[model samples]
Target: MNSESSAQIDVTKPHPARRYDYWLGGSVNYEADRASADAVAEAFPTIHLAALENRSFLRRVVTYLAAEAGISQFLDIGAGLPTAGNVHEIAQDITPAARIVYVDNDPIVLAHARTLLDSSAQGATAYLDADVRDPERILTHPNLLATLDLSKPVALMLVAIVHFLTDDDHPHDLVRRLCDALPPGSYLVMSHGTDDYLDIEDRAETSAANQRSGVPFQLRSTAEFSRFFTGFDLVAPGITSVTTWRPEGWRPHPRKEAVSMLGGVGRIGTRAVG
Candidate 1:
C-alpha cells in the first residue's frame, strides 16, 4: 500500500476507470477497455453522450464551487484518468491557491497521476491510490493530509462513480462516510446513473451486458440516488438531468435521454449526518 508497485495494472481485465478514459477519447486505455466499452455501447448505443454530459456537468460544478461558493479545496474520489478541465485546473484557474487531491484505485490512473500533479505555483495537487470503499484510508492518507485542510470547506466530488458500487455494497452509506469527514459549508457535487429514462427492457439488457463483462454496476432510481444527499441542501435545479442542472445556455444538447443522469451540488450542514 505504501508503494506504487503494490497495485499492479491488469491489462487483460477491463477497469471502469480505463473504460471511462476510453469513452472520453483519452489514449490511456487498453484493448480490453475498448472491448468492454464497445460491449456497453452495443447495449446502450448513446453511451458516448453520457460520458460527455458527465464531464460537462463536472465543469459547471467545479466552476460554481470555486468561483461562486468559494470552496478552496477539493477531494475528488474515484478520480478517473485525467482529461480536459480537471478539478485542480478549473479550481486553480478561478483561485490560484485552490488545492485538490485526486483519489483513485485504478493502477493505470495511479501510474499516470503524475500528469495530474502539474499544479500552479499557488495551488497544490496530489493523488492517492485509494479505493472509495475505504473512506477512512482516503481521508487520512498522507497525500490528502499534505494537500488539503480538512477544517476548511472541501468539495467531495463523486461524479459518475456510485453506479459502479453494487447494491450489496451499501453505496449510500459509503457516500455518507465520505461526506461526514468534510467540514460544514462543504459540498457534495455528486452524480449518478438511473433507469429513469431507459425502458425496463433496455435496463435489463444494459445490466446483463455489463454482468457478462464482469462490470460491477447498478442503476438506481432518482429517490434512491437522492438519499446520498440526505444531510445537505441541493443547489437550484435540484437532482435533474445532468444537462438540466443550472445549465449554461449551451447545455441540453440534442442527445436527450442518451446522457440521462441525476446530478446536483448539495451544501452540508453543521452536523456530520442529517
Candidate 2:
C-alpha cells in the first residue's frame, strides 16, 4: 500500500465504499466495514444478491457505453475497489483505445487502484482521490483529464454509489452540475436503491437499520430517480428494476416479496445514432 498520507487507509470507521467491497467478497475492506455490512445483511437478507446484480449492471453499462454508445472515454465517479470486468477492462474490450478515469475519496480504494493501471498499450487508466460533491475538481483532476478527453463524449458512471450521499449533499444538483460540464452525446448510467418493491414494514425497518448503522440510505421513488435523468433520453427499456434492466439472459428469478433496485441508462443531450 502507498504509505503516503494521501494513500493511508482509514480503517477505523465504517465506510460505505469499503462495506460495499466487503459485500462483494473483496479483501480490501476492514473490520468496521465487515461489521456494518453484516448488520445490513441481517436487515435485508437479499443484500448479497443485490450487490452481485449491481456489479453485473456496471459491466453491462460499461460494455454498452463502449460498444453501442461508441464512447472511448469514461469517468467512473465513486469508483470502489478495482475488480473483475472493471470499467477500463470492459470498455477496452470493445475499443482497445478506451481510456478510463476512476474517481473516489477512499484512500484504501486509491491504494488498490494502482493495480488497475496495467492497461493495454492502446488504452490507459488512472485513479483520482477526489470526492463526488466537487464536480469541478473531479472534472479538472490531473489524472482524470490526462486519461479522458472531457471535450469528447464520455460515459459518466454513478452505479450503486449515490445512495450514500444524504439529502444535505444535494445529490441531484451534484449530478446536474457534472452533466452540464459534459458535451452533448455524453451518457449517464446509474443504479439506485428503492423500496418500491418492498413491503411497508420491511421498508421502514430497512431504513431504520441503515440509519442505526451510521450510514443512512435514501431510497428514492421511481419518479425521484428519473428526475436525475431530466435532460437525457432514456434507453429502450427505460428506468425499471435493476434486475430487469437488460439481464443478458442471466435472469435471477426474484422472490415476489423482494425489494427491487431501480436502474437505468440515459443518453445526455443529443441522441447518438448507433
Candidate 3:
C-alpha cells in the first residue's frame, strides 16, 4: 500500500470491493465487510453463488473476446480485488500481446494495484484509481491512453458493477460515453444484477437487505439492462443468465433463476442497432 492510498483505507466501514472479496473467500476484508456480506447473504442465500458465477462469467467472456473475437485490448471498469483469474491473465494467456487498463475507485484496490500490473512479457497492464460514474475521466485518463489504442477494438468489461449505480446516476449515459469513445469493432462485455428471476417476495427482501448492508445496489430488469447495448450488436446466447452464458461443456448448468444475474457481450458496429 502506498502512503497516499494507505491513508484512505477505512476498515471500519465496508466497501463494495472488500465486501465482494469476502464473498469470494478472499482474506483482505475487514470485519465490517464480512458482516455486510453476511447480511446480504441472509436475505439472498445464493449471494455467494452469484459472486462466484459472476467471476466465472468474466473468465468465459474474456476467453471469447481473446480467443474467438480476436480482441487484444481491454478496458475493464469496476475491476475488483486481485483474484485468481483476472482479465489480463486470461486474455494474455490466449493472446500474449493483449493490453489491459483496469479502473476502480476503491483505495484498497489501489493499494494492491501492483498485483494487477504484473503483465506478460508481450503484454501490458495498468490500473487507474477512478470510478465508473465518471466515464469521461476514465476514457480520457493518461494511463488508458498510454496502454490502449482507442482506434482499435477493445473489450470493455463492466462486470457486476453498474448495479451500484442507481437510476439517478444516469448509468446509461455514462456507459454510452465510454462506448462512444471506442471505434467500431470494440466490444462491450457486461454482467448485471437483475430481479427479474426472483419471486416478488424474494426481490423485496433482497432489495431491503441490500439497503441495510451499507452498499448501494439496484437490480434492473432485462429490458432496462438491455438498453445499455443500444448501439452494439449482441453476440450469440445474448443477454442470458451468467451461468448459462456458454457454460463449460457436457455438464448440466444451474437454472437461470438460481443466479439472478444477466450477462451479455455486444460488438460495436458501424451503425446503431435499429
TM per candidate: 0.96, 0.93, 0.96
Worst 10 residues of 3 by lDDT: 1-10
Q: Model 2 Cα displacement at 257 (Å)?
A: 5.5
Candidate 1 clashes between residue pairs 3 or more apart in a chain or in different chains? none
Model 3 ranges off by over 4 Å:
1-7
Model 3 TM-score, 2 decimals: 0.96
RMSD of 3: 2.0
Clashes of each: 0, 0, 0
Candidate 2: which stretches are off by over 4 Å?
Answer: 1-7, 255-259, 270-274
Q: Of models 1 and 2, which has the larger lDDT?
A: 1
Residue-pair clash count for candidate 2:
0
The Cα local distance difference test for each model comes to 0.86, 0.81, 0.89
- Candidate 1 structure quality by residue, lDDT tens digits, 163-272: 99998888988888888888899999988888888888998888888887667888778999888888688899788888787778853364446876778789999985
lDDT of 3 by residue, 11-82 (tens): 898898999999899998999999899989999888888899999999999999999999999999999899
